[model samples]
Target: MTTWTYAELAPDFRYWLREGLPVGLPGVVAVSLDGGGHYARRFEDAPPALTVEATDFLLPLQPPVLYGDAQGLAVRLTDTGRAFDDCEVVFQAESPGFMLWTIHTGPLADANHVVRVPALPDGRAIRMISGVEVTCIENRDFADPTRPERTAVGASRR
Candidate 1:
């Protein structure tokens, strides 16, 4: 339940995917945080004089909601300011080396889900917990994407 705010369209504002990676498609998100956390994006229309791409920071009272599975773990937002119904929660397999996680959640937000990474070579150790597609993981409608291949970083979830 961490809430972070940042300018969506600012030069100084840098998120996780700073290298301009295609998170999904054209509507790729610049910032990627712990699965199911509040994200603040700056709009392009922002005034240019604004040097600091961020302002009025407000962190959530509760800490980040940690989980181990392939479900919606982060908040998803659309370019039009609308959030999707469900977002995918991609987590690193709990196993050592590269292993596939047994996911049971639908797209991530519809129902409770789980991801179990077995033991392998480069196990789920340095990977970050994240989700794709859903927005606002608070007491609201949540959705998610199921792809261990994405969250595990270098492992195959198959």
Candidate 2:
């Protein structure tokens, strides 16, 4: 049984969504929620290993749903839209916050392909994609086992 929290697995999940799934990675898949209150599996190469439906939620507005099955686990966010298939997502996580780096490789490659989303505890998780930055309110603090005092937030070249 694995005991990794959403904070710990978030970066890996984002990477898988941004990039393609590696050969043998067997963990939870992450899905972003759209404004319509529906959960979508964005990655074409690797879809959600588990079955996740919006009816699973107790309420229509509730978000950040987690589902696990024989295949693995999945976390679906209710406020974000589908991740762009042509962008490469890189993320860094720490206590209290996490950052997502998206690199666009499509026709917009000539434009600013790099965008960052900085998440703060009890603050806003910014979503920057396609030249638009949307802010979503976060309810809880991100907790990382490695660092208890402060969570690191930044983007680095991969």
In terms of lDDT, the poorest run of 10 residues in model 1 is 147-156
Candidate 2, backbone clash total: 1
Cα error, candidate 1, residue 66 (Å) = 13
Itemize residue pairs with steric clashes in candidate 2.
Answer: 18-89
Local accuracy of candidate 2 as per-residue lDDT tens digits, 4-48: 112123443433333335444322233334432222222223333
RMSD of each: 13.3, 19.3
Candidate 1 segments whose C-alpha is farther than 4 A from its true place = 1-36, 48-84, 94-97, 100-109, 112-158
Model 2 vs. true fold: TM: 0.21
- Residue 53, candidate 2: how far off, in angstroms? 1.8
Question: 70, model 2: CA deviation in Å?
Answer: 55
